[model samples]
Target: MVTDKQNISVNVVDYPYDTSVPLLDNEQFFYIRDEKRHKGRGLAAILTQPPSVQYRTLAERVKNQSKYGFPSHKLVLLIHGHQSFKNALYQPLLADKLSQEGYYVLRIDFRGLGDSEDCWDPKLGRTIKQDVEDLTTIYEFVSSEACKLLLGRTLTLDTIVAHSRGVISMFEFAREVYVPNLINCCGRFDSHGLLLKAARRSPTWEADGGFYCHTLRFGEWQDVWIPKAETLSAGTLDSSKFKEIDSGTWVLSVYTATDPIIPITAAAGYSNLFAGRHTLNIVPNCDHNFYGLPDDPNKLNLSLRKGKVNYGVYLVKELVEYLKEENQLERFYKTHQLIKSAKNEGDVRNRWCLPYEFSQISNFRDVGGYTTGSGTQVRPGIMYRCANPNEATAGALDYMKSDLSVNKIFDLRATNEAIEGGIIPEFDVENLSFNNNMTLSPEEMAKHYQGMFLSSYNFPQAYEIVLENSLPTIRHIFEYVLDGNVDEKHAIVFHCTAGKDRTGILGMLILGIAGVDVDTISHDYELTTLGLCTEKRLIAKINGRGDKFYTILGPKGREIAAAYGVTPTEMAANVLSSKYEAMRLFIDSFLSKFGSFDRFFYEQLKFNKIEVEKIKFHLTI
Candidate 1:
């Protein structure tokens, strides 16, 4: 019995205003656009007074009895994402749901769809950027009217709920504007992956200009062939660019347990990119569109209590609850900021630093939880990386053995460095040396430090040398991980002295191949300074003990060390430090030289295709 007549009502609620004077009493359906597009699209919006409450917003104050409604209040904006999707799909249901809960809501559609007018020319290609532009225009209008309605009182936008592809526009808008809260539902960060799949299915989509995207709509399959140019121009979802986001913008990623266009792992991928800035809320038994499962997939399983479940109501409820609670809202964002600034150190995962009572164990932390573009996350608590575990506390060693379930340790230090540092426990250790004085000698190392005191270029070049030389050793490390006996719960630790240089390069290669972004890799490498500052200082403390350490440094190195009040060894190790740039440059070289991380694994490392899957499956979920 549902018909076009079932379109959501445009009735806007009004109250006692200057009745004689004209006011925006009814929902206004008008045209809005960006600076360029004079031929704009339709925007339907309504602002209403907050629901009368008996208590003050923050509590411990007299409740307002004024008929005009509370001046300072909560407001929400709902937006549909894809140009193909209509606002009527969920706008009315959400608008009413939020309004009943004391929020003034405004929902809108992008141009060229629903009630919204088409962009002047269809040939301009409806890109996500245009949707962003349209959204920006609407927000400006809504905010202005909202401020007036609230009488200049502060309006806390609980969140702007954007669905699917609409999340792309919302994220883009927040990067530039002040978006207080954001909810991204089933958003795909890797647009290329979708296209690649499409190309595989159609075989001629990319070259022929379009592809058939068969999607389920209204319980029926439909051919939704969109142009390749339009999708490509929408831009890829590179969340690394969102690191420096607006201070006020708190992001919450919510997705159904089942997804069609985007993978279930996409949520984890976003959290990986957003790091501490994002939290996840999974809606069980629902698909990408937020529809519930009709028949339980567990109908055959009588051993477990399970049945058909729907996320339709549960999804919206979680969102509303997140907005209401400050703890849930600010959790991930605060955590992310703390880690990014290196303000936290209780756990290595908190800031990716290895805590130790002694100087040997540095940069020790799990390397899993990084995600590939396909939404697969490197399983957490599995792969750990660090500096030498030589002379590690028994308790610390026990924690790694038991908690991390680490059975293997790949030691990347040269035989000499191992002998000098003292060998780690003989059991569970593999010496995979990269710098064996093969190309760079101890004198050359001293010279490199001396030259480095003059310029900063040698730091990343040192990383390049590790990447260039440690081919077989790196292959074996992955092989250990890919071994059939290993599972997601099992972990292995890789280390070298200082863990910031050789350890960092190896860490970067592993994480990079695992699909971690450059920013995260840099962040992980930079965590070494927080964990090893004392270790670096220990070098300076050995002032008179190691005279040979200074003698190896000739003159220039000695001058740099003395100026810094440390030995030449300290000068070399401490001067390099754990820099974000060092790891970043290393990854850049990896990508440039190898073409792709996976290709480097298969072609350069000579890993079989089956082994590659084993590696990814074991490493990522």
Candidate 2:
């Protein structure tokens, strides 16, 4: 039996997980939180080296919560089948078994199942779509701040294992959310297919995609009419469409030989769809619940062939083996797709963008092979930027507080805006007063403005600010860069809210001064719009109110230019007009004040000269 004897540290934050809050009933679900404890032989540790990955964190909620050396770990969140939550005795037992073999388990009762606050009812006319939403919400909660608090910092979720109906909900969740590992046990196909088969057998089944589907036959309304086998058999599983993820994401499919819900052929078909990316295990003699007993209410007559059954020690061993691939796990899973997106499209989920999570307003990104004058590209993550920290998640705040170890935060927001938003909480909130706010009253400015004045006033004001209020701030930023902190565990993050306008202007100027081309700067600045777009659901809500402003203003170029307080022309010039009048004046004035910009950076900031040069070389080349 495994005995956790080490002085395991617990870091749970006291956060509430309330169930009464009204759910949007639209793509939002809840993940039940359950923890079980028992004894076992120590499971071989996986994901040990990546200092980034939290390992063996034990929570105080488990039975024998105080045991130390056992190396407390997190259980995968498992969702049970329809009516399955009503009976989760098997889940805890499974968790116990896995724990004996070293698996911390968290079996959740789906929102509508078991002791969960919500319940699904055909008479109430609840749609499966609602269930899907509830599942997603629950999934997020499981991995969110409130869930993390429950587990504490010492133990965190290492994987998510979903069963049957839970797998369907999780499949939806995986498409939208990012989880490292997923284990599918006795998973079935989609709801339409599952319901269709039931409908054929019991005429009461009716198609329900939620609110959109309802049918009346003669004088009565039939519950469901959709056929499952016909719909799915017509088209194979579309695994190719899944978001391109890194190889580090591992998938394991576990099926029982006698499971009626998921026959061996069907399981094999699903496994084949994932092919190289997935592994399949079939348990022998066991029923769907994996317990033996012919007359058990929970048992199913799922026929098992000797060839298909590969249960017991072998399945557990394979799971342990696949999870231990050191090389893949060591470097954080940066999928080729993720790397590409971050470099080309500015996807926040990209590996390079991970740094942004730490800074409240950092326009954090990877500076991949962006060509310099010398035909080289800056290394990703060596530099980052963002809007002011008016809003930051607790996880983000902590990253800034410690891991970032940043030396400075160049605030570009007018002092008024900063105060209005409340003082940003940071170790060092440097006030580089780029006090570029317009001095003229709205009336006076309106009278004098012409051309893009009313339309482009914000852009010119951005320029004016850089020329007037931002020079010193730029000098300060340069000094910070030259301080040689770039190579250390710390760097710098600076921003103005709407990180686009002032922040973009400042970033462009800084990169230009450092010899990064204007085109590249414009490209980087424009990418902000991608992240700031309101989610589709919010937009739909607005549309319902006859709102078209977002739809109209969402033109790619317009959005990009708007972020930086300039037109696309200004952006092109910022790059193409490197020697243009505005740029020349800004660069010349800054240099005059501190010799060359590089000199100010090197002499003023304590940065290592070589590292500064290296940074410059990457950007300029």
Candidate 3:
């Protein structure tokens, strides 16, 4: 949709922010009353284009999601300033504009503002610190399982557009957690500036606890009693100590040219603070609220038009341009790319598969972005596969904990294959190992892997053994989806040591079940070797270790390795892969027996009709 000025206009639907659903006359949008009262703050939120979702139960919602393709792949979080929310402010327009740009907007209402619950305390309500806490809580909630389940699709905070005082809280949030792209508009930083502005603006300001301010709303002035000792406690927010977003974060700071409450000169030096990709854009001829009326020295005796055209649209367009930047789009899709391209350390860092130098984990990929042959795509962030979580680097562990949110791991390694780093992860794990007793001698194991060419039947026999033995466990894993608790099982990572053989077989099954074409599945399986090659390159380069690290140790190294049927190249491939033909033939053999995946689920796995329906409902688009 486009506004009169051809400004992009995005439509929004209100969905559940909290656990409860709101009453709505229009099913497209929901109106959640801001009645949540917490520690001196209240909150509410609007979910834009929440997959056109309106259902009473989680199953119904998810089924509906499969029926209606979720078109918007991006999610944006819009946080309001000091005393604002969506409606009765310019934030709705901003949210809609972002929606028009294919971003799902979660417009937040801070406590004690808009239609949200009221805060009785002055210092505690909407203070920078408290607001920062609110931001963290809201972000966590938004990126959580319940929130994703409600939307019937996975969502991440792509860009955060904050106005006025919300920017300070966002800055604090940027330090506490990752803020993808932060757009700060007319934000006041530093404690002295805010208190000085407060004192100057409020009529009944006092040095003591009792201060009357018009902050609660425009028409009413309210008294907030902060004790003399605690009066300036939260008022002094220092941005000097904040961390730089230089490490692959995008920051854009905008200010109104004529913002009376926040001087343009105050933000003039702000751009110099960031060492990363940062832009400072000042919207000309606007006030702090941008489109809202400005406090002009020239308008002493004049009355004005209510709102002709929101001069604010110009300011909001800046946000759209920033959002539309290629870097931002890459940042958005990088999460969904299962097989990452190792172009550089910077590009590697932006993706989910962290390099081996920083990642003990190998072949880590969330299996959510596979596009089915029928056109719908598997949602990202839920299904995942990686090398044993037990072998993950500290950075990789943190990534899994904070970003990937892998709560359950299914170990597909044999007892010996998973040794030191084989203990269950921090979260729950089911020790479902296949090929547990395939104890060929070292020479025989090497030959078994080395002699398996693309046309060789040994490859298919190998994976068929895996499929035959692992069917029961795999059935349990999928059936667990319908066990009534989807929250604790948000992301399920199944893996062996290299995450290639057993893990790849399972990945093929998952992709095949999701209706991704066999060709895509073959390529996805092929990525294991590429990903492991990246690991090998990293291992070779780390600490001045060169290619010799991956090659024979000496003249006898090749002879010794070869006697065990393990040359350097074959040795590396042995650990990382067999071939896609292994899975292809294994699946072809399965088809020869069971006929179809549906039949295999019924005959081999013994899933009843209802269970089969549940599997189709959960896995398919």
Candidate 4:
């Protein structure tokens, strides 16, 4: 129902420049004010009116003021490239679009460009180092109390969207500042390529120390001095500097496939360096400035033109989607109270209802205290799910043995997985690998599952495959409980690498057999999203195995991946996410075919009525 209408008001303001930085006197930036009010309608107005007329309004206001209230206002900073003003290319359009989306958008003109004061120092020019200093000055001013008073609201500078040469300065600024999100539009990766192009244009410039080149600035052509110092400063940049950026910063590199300026291969350099934290989006049939091909039928040129197909819209689209995800993640963290839980051990255990907290372990929690359909509760301290305990501290192992009385462990990993991630040597562990009873050879099975785990869209299908092949493992686990091996006195813990996918399936089977509803089972699986160690392991696995799976896809696989608009690492992160819908869909499909959990146990798992009764008796109280 939302239309692309300019409903927000933008204000242009000038803040005093940082006196510490030389040759910068005044700086100017534009910020869009979000007019949407957060507080409820006045209570005095409601009470002054008759109850019948104002009751609905009061109820609506009350509903709006609940725990999930209005989203916090976020500030987005847009940086322009060299020889470009703040309004160049997509900057103005993007700023308006983001403002319409309820964000406080700031589009700044770096010194020596646009409406800002010029830096005419002959020796300094507009070097990358100077740009970084300019950025720092602006960043510090924004974070100051004076700026907050001017805005009338406290804001967080969460995202930075930069174009071309500005991307280099953005990353350089990130070396010290910790902005959560960054967008790179057509950023050049090869500094040597830039220097070579400049050299070809001005052959005698290096010999003469500097040369004047014609550049388009503010709708006019002017001869700007291209200094040798600026070129050398840019040439000194390399991928090693990218490593200094925070590892937690999420990066989005958006490039046009047919860019006339920077080669498309520069996109790969960013994806390679940022690996787990990067997303690459290549818009097709667009130029360096996001202009599309001309609408003429016979036109074969790929240069920027006033075409009907505007690719800058696509660039803004990608930026909006990435920002939406980041905002959702921030909301999720706040809703789940994970900000405090991630810091304090006591808070994590108390808030998440965890009975024990381990310094070296993660996603460890008891699967209990849920009332089943028949009014019986699943007893606490009897069964648990956790990540691999290979790295559990010695004190944690002893605590598990003595305080928790965990006597048995069922590792649900494959043999190769176990070899790669070793086991806990303290417990009486059984390797109930999920790959058992599969008819395919190990090589074929690996290929089959690897392809399935490549994308989150295929996760439900992968769960079905795991269910079909893991019958023997399921039967072994149930028979162990049926044989009076595990009891209330001695608990059991079952796990995989991150205790999410495979462990989730096992937890589903156990709870389903205990007469727990599907919704509860799915929600229990969703709790893995809050695990601290799960995210860390996801990053590690993506960096380690992302390329291997991509290469295994071959040519046809790559074509399919490109069609989906995702890179290999992005797909890997998707696969590892603990989405509630995936588990719910898997359960829905299983119930559709088998009718009920009882029937599934009798037919697929080959458990008799007596054994099923024992499972229920042992799992619930």
Candidate 5:
């Protein structure tokens, strides 16, 4: 038993088994938050010393504690398996290890198992329901104001590590409660397997009311009772509950390939169920307890077995690495103030080219304030560029419609793309299918543009193809804008998927026709990169490319990659970039071909001089 110098009342209870470990300096008693308090109803927990207090002498540690308080603000809960205590297997080692890395580690023994209260009855034994209740009580106590008053400092519950049966309880708790990180070690996926194995082992045990088995308790064999109620409860546990675990929780499931108790397929089951937010790791040559097989002395060579190796080391290694990565990411976000910046819209607004802030939109801004050659500025609030506004929140959509006075939206995506990305239902949207002739169906146009993009060497070539093919759409847009329909009170928004490639081309044309310089046009194109920093559509596009480019280029893809010293994925990411040089090159090539925007509009788009002058007159102040 341990005492706090602050004279906090701690009701210490002795365990059923002996816990004479050398690492008992951090032991403490926490009363279970149970209203019906029977005798011996409490929790036995070990709070490991963090790095700042671990190496200090007793006097120095007490002095430092008196002055500066607890070292860690992050708390990690370590839960043991069925028929196990707080210090079983890797719990103690992992607790100390994680504490040394600046986390407050709490290893607790569940009720009726180790040093906790004996609430286990022969009829109602230790059920999964009971385990879940125990875990909830402990979690509540640790997170409550009562615990804070005792500790003298608040600790945020960061991660939970559970083994075997405790994994079930942890995941069940996660159905309603939220924890940032979860680690599962040697956990069974289905309860049916446990029932089947038990039926085979003890066929008449249920008929006999209960069975007595010799199980390891703190490294010693002890007579343990396996009641009928326990078996029935374990058998009735629904594995579907795992799927109901919170999606935001990051899960890391670790299993050994050679584990006798739990099959390897359990890992795959968790991987499939968790899908996006879980990682599965399988350690080699280990058992359920992560103990390695002893080398066979009868064999000439010791090739098949690892001689008494503790594979628990590998488990701890994976845990440490995963926790370290999570800690580093948390620290990085805190240090860079990204969370605060994301919340404070002003910071993100000032970092970009324009001052528009839409709740559910990215790269949505007014394309205004560009000075033409004649000193007249392209009028602001009349034109905008953005990614798809389909997912924009109601408030953001209202802000766009009422606050910004947006009246029209020119969607430069293919017909299929428009249907797939959806449109702002509140706006009058025109699907400017930029394919030649506009005769192809939505799907055909989508495939056609995809082929063109995949075939082009760089964005400049792609932009040229788009400009050439989309002449009809371009003519319609320019004519519509100049047809006395748009004014300062009403604005128009144009976008493709990311408001980068096709959208950039259209922006260049409008700004150029408004007499904006080539450098400003190029800068406007480059701003798309910053605009898309928070956008996932660009990432989806890059990932969606997959091996299509590799397959298309075949041997030439390798040659090109070798020439540029980049991988296929890198090449794909480059194709998705909105670089200044790419737009500048496209503009230079266009001017070289048609001499000026006037000739290009007249020759390519067949726009008359009156129409061009009307476009210039309407877009500029």
Candidate 6:
């Protein structure tokens, strides 16, 4: 078992202050000598005199110490990666962000790299263990300084947050020592192959045999490495073994699909490793170091970078929430759970406008009580729908880029809608627009019901064409899903504008492919009327309109269908068709022209097989 000495083992040292000229953000450089070693300590820096404004920049800013209930008003050490400590630009943004969130952050110069002295141990070969020991000393020194600043008041080291190699060191110290909390940003494993990948990309650790090497270790159980190999080895670490670890510690592991080195799939696996209390978060396209990288021109390189997405600013906010929640330092607000009143079960309507600026328009939500044929309810977050995220808020965009962690976005909007919207942000957004609506606008098709005249325009050619057009996009959505990205463990959201029309069509298709009855699909589609617009106002508008005008007309499907020769019987089939096989048939017939759906999705839409599977699972089981 690792010792609690990790948290309490740091030595106090009088670090030198870098009185060098300040940087763009008023950041100043400083260093601390190894009080025990009595040598020149490596480079250290702090972003001082930051804008003294709060979250929204209120008139009077509150004092940092009193405002945030950290037992004291001082900073703890911050540890940076091999390259960042020396280079001002490469420093992990998490440190400054955390400092802004109230905790004083330290960007430490790890032993043997950056501003620190070279290693004394030869076996480890510039490993993170020495850095862990250094951090312990830093933590102890900071804790003592904080206590002294408080005039004999006592306080504990509240938390340690690390990224990349630094994350490994933090984990090592936490496992061996006693610390209240740890947050791992892009934690890595101990596999040589994976380590090489990170090393190739990392500007700092590339020369030292990549990140980690996997040497065989003997044990009574399965291949037992250093037990804490994950913290020791960058490539060969296995988080699966964490369940056996027992410590009074709280761990938060955040990952993004776009992370270049760390596979997004490994985030949950690593988080699940710890038996102790934990939280695992996945951001869509973040890189191994948590910085959003620029897109690569080559397709393979682009695919690799797709998981390294980034969110602007809000990561600090999350850390703030995490600190408060874990320490019970802030009041928690329970979301309102009042039972909504509705005229009937079908009348239920709920809309959750997400908190980010760029929420996936393709990601819509479903209530938990919608029962399946087997009498089981569809789980919330399991499946979702939304409009094209061409206009997602910055906050919403960040949430999707850094939180939702979805594998694919199925788009059914016509080519024109997409071209008008411009190319969706390439790094975080995937385009899968396929539909058979060749007739450009509602104006062009006003006189004829392409699918069903009036009630069900039986225009098989137009219907088949439109449906076939959608096949390519849906194919890609499902291909990526089946590739195992969207298993039950992950949630997916699909959508279009007004939560009806294209969005509704996709929703109904999913339900139909899943064996949900027609009434449920229609009811689900109709729920948008309530969720998006006020009924009284809509009714008033319809009543005020002349008899020649239909309320559901003018770009609305119901209106277009009413104007066509659609019959009640055909309408019921479109609205109420429920078997999975039936919906599959409809999709298959449409895709027949474009080859299989898988071909359309993978070959045409550019999504991998994993992305497709995620969407397919929604239809299967």
In candidate 4, clashing pairs total: 0
lDDT of 1: 0.58
After superposing candidate 4, which stretches have Cα over 4 Å from the reference? 1-71, 213-221, 294-308, 325-621
Candidate number with greatest lDDT? 5
Q: By descending lDDT, how would the candidates be arranged?
A: 5, 4, 1, 3, 6, 2
Cα RMSDs, all models: 20.7, 24.1, 18.3, 20.5, 21.6, 24.4
Q: Which candidate is the best by TM-score?
A: 5
Candidate 5 vs candidate 6: the TM-score winner is: 5
411-445 in candidate 6: lDDT tens per residue? 55656766775444533344455554455456434
Worst 10 residues of 4 by lDDT: 41-50
Using lDDT as the yardstick, the better of models 3 and 5 is 5
lDDT digits (tens) for residues 225-304 of candidate 2: 23332223222334444434334355678888877656676576666666556767776665565544454332343333
- Candidate 4 lDDT, 551-578, residue by residue in tens: 6655355654564445667667666677
On TM-score, the stronger of 1 and 6 is 1
Q: What is the TM-score of each candidate against the true structure?
A: 0.45, 0.39, 0.46, 0.46, 0.50, 0.38
Candidate 6 Cα misplacement greater than 4 A, ranges:
1-29, 34-39, 42-77, 86-97, 121-125, 145-155, 193-246, 291-312, 325-621
Give the distance in Å from residue 344's predicted Cα in candidate 4 to where it truly belongs: 19
C-alpha lDDT score of every prediction, in listed order: 0.58, 0.45, 0.57, 0.65, 0.68, 0.45
Sequence-dependent TM-score of model 5: 0.50
